[model samples]
Target: MVRKEKLDSMFNAFSIVSGGNYVYVCDMKQDLSRWSKSAVDYFGLPSEYMENAQSIWNEHLHPTDREYFNESINAIFAGSDNNHTLEYRARRLDGEYVVCVCQGVVIHDDDGKPEYFCGSIKNHDSVNYIDDVTNLRSLYGFLDDLKSAFWKKQELDILMIGVEEFSRTNDIFGYTFGNRALRKLGSLLLSEFRCEGQVYRMDGTKFAVIAQKSSIQRLSEIYADLQETCAKEFYVGSDRLTLSLCAGALHLERFSVSPDTVYSCLRFALHESKGNHHGELFEFQEVVIDESRNSLTRLNEIRNSIVDECVGFELYYQPVVDAKTEEMCGAEALIRWRNNDYGLVPPFLFVPILEQDSLFPELGKWILREAMICGNRIRAKYPNFVMNVNLSYAQLERTDFVDVVLDLLKATHFPAKNLCLELTERCRLLDVKLLQNIFVRLREEGVRIALDDFGTGFSSLGVLRKLPIDCVKIDRDYVLNIQSNKEDRNTVKFISQLAEAFNAELCVEGVETAEMRDMLRKFNVTSFQGFYYSRPVPIEEFCVKYSC
Candidate 1:
């Protein structure tokens, strides 16, 4: 009776500690030593189950996991390790499989012979499962591991491709169709290559694949096949639609020295492919090294210039001449960088980089104030002269841009009519109401706004009709070949007529020769700017060259 009472207490204690009170003991020779009452209950076995314990356990294990489990157990018996832990799917009594984590430690007798092994199993269905981010099984976990271990490699090759202009599809069709199309693409990739490679849904409209030591021939074949597969039309909810993908391939081993280096190389390749008129695949080349290094160096310098004030920026002016008067009317303000080491980096090379960095908002404010002061000095000498300053898309998006202009105008006391704010067609593509309010306020204050690079982007017509623009400057590409190409002449004529319809003045840039000027004159383009008049000159030289 006392022994029975002690056994009850032990069972209750075990239940409280393990929450299951199930235990199984087996020898290294695959013989069962003991099984607790809770073990029989857990496996749903009869009291006579001890006789066939090995077979019962083996039969319950998932076929896919059985071989690995046996190998791990055998290794532990061979004294490979003292403790073993594994996760596998085990068949429950009801015939459904449950994921379980099992851990065991070996015990030895006084004679140094293996006595028995004890282990407990825990339900891992809730704990070990990974959250799904894509349809591909185990993809997120794989990516997490890769991101953690990727730093060990000096280089990596990455391929990123996705449907072009997916946003338009989402807008035209419903988002449900767009999501179905994306899922179909994901499933296709998973079924094709998940066993041999890793895939990631980088973001909306983008997918990436990573390959380690993939040979050039193999990579080419893979890319060609993917391109062909992605090109095929997909049926989403009975509508058949085809989409083209732009692919960028970067070979990390060749260019990457650090973790960030790989990302940079891949991004540069992606940028090149996107900028191509055709959706072509671009491969990493050595030239990208120099280009990337230059970009990084310039970005760092610009960032430093913003904070330190030790480095300063220079302003160059190019004269704008009146067609009929053949005299200087105004000059456009151009920004140049004069690094102590690099010495005079052109605006073309650095301006776009600055825009991408969104440094233009601060840089734009500085340029405005400086240009106002400079224009005030020029106006003191020549009252009717004007100064045009170019503004970037980022600067236009600022709610405070109008206030900044007003503050500068008040501080400098320059005539508002003589200050021209130049904006590209791209700027007008932003929020319409914000642009309208800003332009209306500026125009009401007597400040003139010109649409620079007039024929470049898609929104030119909308810009002229909507924004309160005072002038339209035709881009140089349309003006350069006007004398030799009929197509260019026709384009110039169309733009000039549009300017007339809008009642805005026209400025034709890039007039290098007399023939170009004559051709422009035929279109009634009055204001001209380019090397034909004078190359952009330093402030001192410009003052001497155009001072009246």
Candidate 2:
């Protein structure tokens, strides 16, 4: 009795000295009796709570945390552990909730039997690491903990989880419901992967986990588990939401990986996974990363070359021949790159990358101006010469696209009728109606529109039906095998018929053989272009050969 009173007095003095923070002493072996003046007031507990503090604490804890609280407390009392430090949400007096960190030390009697556990309570509402919405650590907190482990030279695997097509979810159901889905997913991940690692809520629809010292095989298993979990549908309000997850992982070994580099590499891998490896985990490879970095550096050089009007940027023209006469009736303008160090960089390698960037429109403008100027210079000698320039989605979607073409024609005194803009299938159009309107205006201005790579995309028929296109350029795949493959010949015949029905010309690309040309002739292909007649050549060489 005397010993108990002395401990109580010490706790009371300590609580007062600690600026009224909640402090408690519990006789774990004896009915779990406890005392704390601050906790009594903060939790709205009566004096009776002291008789059974374990029960009272358990009652106020968040339901999800109840088992953990019991396990940790029981472990200490059973002498399996000497101390316990845990954070959990606890309900307060006015029905509000706050996260509290409780740390306790187990005291032993003369015979080393467990006697009591004493602890202080710290309210962590202001500086809590836990995200309020997801109940996971915030990105900042996760990075901090990750850096700590990284500095200690521990082998680690970091996985970034992204909710696929998440933007469509927000667009369809509104952000409020989107947030609910995220919260549910966060809870699901936390509950499922607690043993494997700590999960963190990354910015918008991206979550991450730091699996400490996990092997590649274990990470692969975890990734498979996550895929299965996300495959199940979740209910939000009355709507059922289904999500597909893409994960990217980077293995970090001690001195080899820096925090910044790890994040950069992991994010890059995640983007690749989302775009190309759907439902799979992409592990970072040094060679792939090095290639990407080198490509980016080379692209930067290309961008600088374009901006500075460097000689590295030039257009090469490939002859488009009349299939029967083999006459060079027109040509398609193709962009090429040449650097002092890399010599002539392959257009197949760089053009597609540039076409997807913002600078593509600017590059398109340059191509249009140069091609028009060259076409005007040659029109007197060859009145039937046509200038075909390719257009990317970035260029065609710009509001000033038609105006830019018109301005270039006026500046170069080039006939709009001779200028053809080829729209490639790779372009993604958001506003088909807007494009149709632009096409109508351009057609009125005497500019022809050709649908390039016609048979490749899902929207090819839709484009023909809706847009004012003048020509259909059948993709090369059908033409390459038309001589041997009956299906290829039938497809070409069908496309030729379809084009004629629309009052459009059908030009077959990739006619590399005399047999291919003869085969296309049967389908009434209006024009043929490929290595058979000529490959893309410099503007100077093209003028010297085909000017007259």
Candidate 3:
């Protein structure tokens, strides 16, 4: 049995962590009650309610829940149960319904009659289950609801929605205003799905909806509504923002799957929908399982190879040239994997998988060491030549990242001024202050920083204004059509102007055709890199051709 002192302490601790949770201590003989401050404020109960707490509970509980609530209490009083736990929807002072979980233990007097009940009531509206920013159910709450649905064998249509370019939004407007946009999105979802489903914040800029058993046509209609709604402009702090979102759906009745499997399938479908349907919804297919299984096996094999360093992993250098002179100015290091089973693995197939692994740090360091050593040799012939190496977000987050780079430069006898680190748009989750400090220290050491995949990501005018970068590598998407597509040409022209304003050099990558290179030069872009010059080749070949 829990003593009164222990119950008091538990109640005190519970009130602090559970948001609007309230503890009630009832004296049956005295017919009196006391409530935690949070509970009184949340429910807006008058002082008179303390005198008749039992009546107030019945009055506030929904009519459908009152019978169950009374039965549970009666069962405990009658000695059929030691305690009672109730989960039901109750009416709040605002005439809104709130799901609540309440558990109570009855204490008996010496005569065996119930003397008091100790209970804690948690309103689901509290932040314990809802996201503070979105006001939707959080991941924890989503899991709980999913479990309950599984137990009840209820059919649910699940959708996973992801905000495209959300990271760019945060980078440009700052996270404070980013949260406001998320809140607005949450409000929009709640209003639309109030009678259809429950919206949950699955992760940063990702949301999930669990809808009641509905027809496939209805689901499609809902998806279309969401897509159209999100396409409109968002008003945030004097700035109007346009956003895009993609969604993936899983029909629960079609298969028997665990909660984890549901999450995986939805995520995979979501990824496939990207650039496939232009933010439209994609349904999970049977092939997803086979693909996921094969992918995991391949990922495991590659992870082991990276860790053991037994697989043939090598770096190839592609030359970056001056547009006007057609002279090589620098080289970007690219990785290749020669596996006995897979033969040759292209980066598009393996790099994304590896970068998601924690062990990528080891691979990244290996690349850095090997690239710098090779670059040092190349520099012997051309002292002004620079080598650019891509840095993953994982590598940059390491506390020892800056130190490792500095040490590599010292060990390779490579000039820091000639070794550039390229950060890509794939780095979405970043600590801005931490990255800025790291960049500041690196710049002090004479190391150059470059932003790769420039026009493709959320690289806004604001991010360029704040980030301490030395170069911008325009993504191939923009450069490929710069000569033929007027929009592409205009985007490149604007980016070139921004680079000039920042005093940063612009290197237009994927410059395959003479027309593309010539068009970029018109915008005053001098540095170019792509197949037009040479595909990535072995160090020996690079040394023989460029004599470096």
Listed per model in order, the count of residue pairs whose N, CA or C atoms clash below 3 Å is 0, 0, 0
- In the range 1-548, model 3's lDDT, one tens digit per residue, is 24445445645655566555678876555656667866676666775238667677777787867877777767765667768767766777788777777888877889988777667887776546778888788887887677557645678888888898898989998999899999888887787677778889987788888998565456668778877766765566677787888888877753234455466567756765774677878886443324234443444456667768636788899999987899988899998887666666667765753564557889999899999999988888888888999988779889999999999899989899999999887664476677788989999999999988897544666667778989988988887767668998888888888899899999988988887777788996869999989999989999999875
Ranking by lDDT: 3, 2, 1
Model 2, 103-188: lDDT tens digits are: 88877888988777777878765665667778789866665566556435567778888898898888998888788889988987
Name the TM-score of candidate 3. Answer: 0.52
Clashing pairs in 2: none
Deviating ranges (above 4 Å) for candidate 2 = 1-168, 179-227, 233-240, 245-296, 303-311, 397-400, 428-434
TM-score of 2: 0.58
Native-referenced Cα lDDT, model 1:
0.69
Candidate 1 C-alpha lDDT tens digits along 325-435: 868888899988787666787777656545634456788888888787887777777788889999886788777889988988998887799999988654644677777
Q: Give the TM-score of candidate 1.
A: 0.58
Of the two candidates 1 and 2, the one with more favorable lDDT, higher being better, is 2
- Taking every candidate in turn, the Cα RMSD to the unseen true structure, in Å, is 15.2, 17.6, 13.6
